[model samples]
Target chain A: MNTIALLPHQQSPAVELDYTTFQTLLRARMKQAPDREFLVFPETDRRFTYREFYEISVSAVDWVGRQVEQGGTVCIIFRNTPEFLAIFFGAVALGITVVPVNPDLAVPEIRFIVENSGSHSVFFDPDMKGKLVPLEAELPEVRFSPLADVSELPKVDVPAIEAQLPHVEMTTPAAIIYTSGTTGFPKGVILSHMNFLVDGKGIAEWFQLNADTRSLCILPLFHNNGLVVSLASALHAGGAIIMIDPKASLRSFWALVERYNATFTSVMPSILAAILALGSDGRPGYLKGIISGGQYLPPSLGKRFESRFGVPIFEGFGSTEATSYSCFQAYPAERRAPGSVGRVMPISEMKVVDENDMEVPDGTEGEICIRGANVAIGYHNLPELQALRFRNGWYHCGDYGSRSREGDYYFSSRKDDLIVKGGEKIYPAEIENVLCMYPEVTECATIGIDDAILGQEICAFARLKEQTLVTESELLAFCAQSLARFKQPKRIVIINHLGDMPELPKGPTKKILYRVLRDYYERRLANSQDPEGLKWVLGSQGGG
Target chain B: MTIPELYAALSPLAEQVLRIPQFDKTLTMMSTPSWDSLRHVQLLSAIEQKFGIEISGDDAFKLTSAEKLVQYLHRQTEGKPQA
Candidate 1:
């Protein structure tokens, strides 16, 4: 185990949060401002004040207590709904770990998480009956309960349930978030209550959040960005949050922000791209800034969005391992660097280290590592992976980046995402960033393909702007102007050329799945027939 | 087009766009795992193309269930020439 320490400058009241567990925080918020609106779900037009949310959570405590014990784990599968949070808060308050699974995942994937987490019961939304009903028989040991609405939870005595709630320590595991692994099954990241509280406090402090801070949650609650950055941060600050179903909220993003007076919202880069693609004109209203992370935010895209919408995007860098974000761009727009993710937050320490875990000099690219109370307890049920990743008192982030002399961190690429061609290393972001500068390119991704001689070749996939026509050859020429000859793509695939994939293959959060693109290149473009009319501009047949 | 007629016309498109085994009245954004936000947009776009009409963003998200979609389309195509 690694010793956790606060940074030297942890002086902000937000950073010096005294509450230990989530329950304590929630109780404090309720006591401070019981009448203040805490969570608002626009899809169902549901609003819950702090007191109401606490009451519902108490109901959930009683409801889940009947099924699972204090030390057991429960899986909650629901879209961004209050029911999900209620169950989550209930389970964690009772010292039971809650595993929140994305309901959109295939049944097999869902089963893998439930079984791997060894969850005793799964409290799923009634809407997922078609999927979970069949799993009950398959996993006979696990109890499957459908919770359609918070109203369905038996109205239990709030005081009695609160009194009987187990004494949960700050170190008690709160949730096991399973990140989509690059290779086989996804690994479960065990986040304790202290991790959530510390990370949430860090975000709250970094953003300078207060009771007036209204967060419009456009991301799914299952992810750390939504959980900590949006929900937990707001809770820590006694702020209000308007939660909407991520899928259903894209078109209404501006409207919701304006209606709720949302001062802050967290989203992925793809969401920003999607909103930009909408081409609808709207004011930013009270929206102070957009928090972007979970993937690389192309500097061009970030600049374009900020210029167009007049809202600064505070792009950060972190993984599920460090809760949501460990570092973020400086607040108060004028202080931000143009292309950096920003300096490390005061709650954590971030250092770029080489393969041997030695600190690299400034302006040198190396793997990014984080150490702080915010770092997770480690992966669940995977001791070997835990040992490998969380070693030497630092959580190896597996992302390659460098810190500038000014202390600004620039994320280069994922360690695995690096493309080495002809004995020279290249980050896909290098080429993708250049491609995005083109007028018609809305979003793009670059990946390394298997090359017989060079070990890997470059392939770029681009999604064009709406109703825009740019041939692959033209894009290739455009890329040739900006990128080096060695780094230029050998092939460019217009992803939406034939309308087969109207959008790039993405995960639930809309992060572009480069592995899926690699597999597509291997199976469809390289191996078999090109039925989808993937417009591949092969620039120079062999190595670039 | 009546609701049932609209439903009949939408069944195949929903199945294709959503990639579901079948489409039923009970199928909704909540009930159907495959009918995600992206597919919802696709389904709406396909409906717009097939019926030669446009669905505004405001009305699009409200049409979650198959029943709601058929009703919404019936109103959209009513008193208008359908493609």
Candidate 2:
């Protein structure tokens, strides 16, 4: 039997293992279960076994070896495609750092990410022909390669760059993932291989993942949730992953699930709402569980989905700065606590603290801070932000929340999103959560609108369900019934759709675009008489 | 008929209504502020009604600037084939 060293506190009685690197993890899985299916995507009619995927990935590694020098940064500007996975891992294999850029970013945003990352080479999808034209002239040193042309890249028998590669200690920087700066310029969160390894191993151990485990990839791989929790975790756990096309909306997701018999999936609350809107009959039969992140999962929707599908919608939370999942509700409806995001993992530790970094008592709201092996080293080229967020050996997550006496963490609100209305502290998420319970409300965002009398008033931008219509007053009444008067939105703006729904950008660790929505509505409110009038104006103007 | 010409022809109120910044003459309307499929539909329909010229769907998708819109108008008025 092959000797497997044991990691500290590893409870795997069957196989004592210490997988230090992603490459080692992949190779071990291939040796142990070469014939097992490694990846499945029925929507694209693509499935690869462990042997097949390993071979291709190795070949891709060899291919990239000839193309890039050591320590070169390769920018990836493709949607969530299988090719993206191959390219990402392929670059990693060659000791090259990969910067996955969101393909849906607007021109200016795209330019900022690419330029700020200081990447000299990029691999792009052919579909983005016109989008990059504006910035192409400015990037004189940047070389662009189309994915469509990669097949035609001449195969040279170049020696493996492995020998030339430096010893990549787990603590060495692997990649710099950019946070979606909805409020300011995007920051590069410098994550090392150790950060990723700890997160993947920690989450896998916590969730009991193994070679037989399969996770459906619906979230954006550019973001940490899809990359770390879904892809990296599968790699470390010796499991299979199915890539979902970013363009394939929730409308056709269940069919794809049935085709692949997907065991697990992950998505944000908006995506969950979209799936729920598809009806219970629309749910696929093969799903074992889904880890919902990127946004808070409303208990009502979570209950509706779990009761209807018989598959638990497990709520998980983490930030890009901390890799993927820091905390999650495991299995069994009995162990699950309502409205709680669950306890921290074994490899991770958490403390709810005030602005002074002192721990708050249980049941009191405070900034939820995290300390673990999974936390990133620091942000690249951002000393100020690095010092601010990473201090005293802990990641000061800007999220405000409280912990129950039982150690269950409950999310309250973002410290930045707190509204002081007439000296009353109100969280928009609390109001938005109440509004989401209403059947007519497909999605809602709360923002503090300018009010000369009250200094600031709560205004809600709501997208109603299809063919389901309710007056603004009725929606407000629903909020009034469930929440305190101060928490109730002073005004509601009803619309057909909040966004494209799928291509919505998520924060580093899959948080919703609340800051983006707030800015958008604030701009809208600046020019309009009222929230209702802004809705009418926006609808009439045909600008989403 | 360039984007600049269109911006020049329109009053400042119309420019503000469009919500686009700077009228670059060489740019296409599709790249402009109010140029999404829905907004394009409304803008084109209004333009057609105002100018009394029908824009084919194919040509409409291809029209990136006000200059292209003017060319399409000239072609329609000059009895040229719509294609």
| Predicted model with the maximum lDDT | 1
lDDT of each: 0.80, 0.65
True contacts kept of each: 0.23, 0.00
Every candidate's DockQ is 0.25, 0.03
The alpha-carbon RMSD over the true interface for every model, in angstroms, is: 10.6, 11.7
For model 1, residues A329-435, the per-residue Cα lDDT tens digits are 99988899988998898888889999899999999999999888788888898888878888887889899999999999999877677665533346677787778
- Across A72-118, the per-residue lDDT of candidate 2 in tens digits comes to 87788775665676677677766677888866555655677778888
Interface RMS deviation of candidate 2: 11.7
Q: Write the per-residue lDDT of candidate 2 for residues B1-83, one digit (tens) a residue.
A: 44344445442433444445544444443234244322344455456655556654334444545565556655554643332
Docking class of 1: acceptable
> What is the Cα-based lDDT of residue A362 in candidate 1?
99
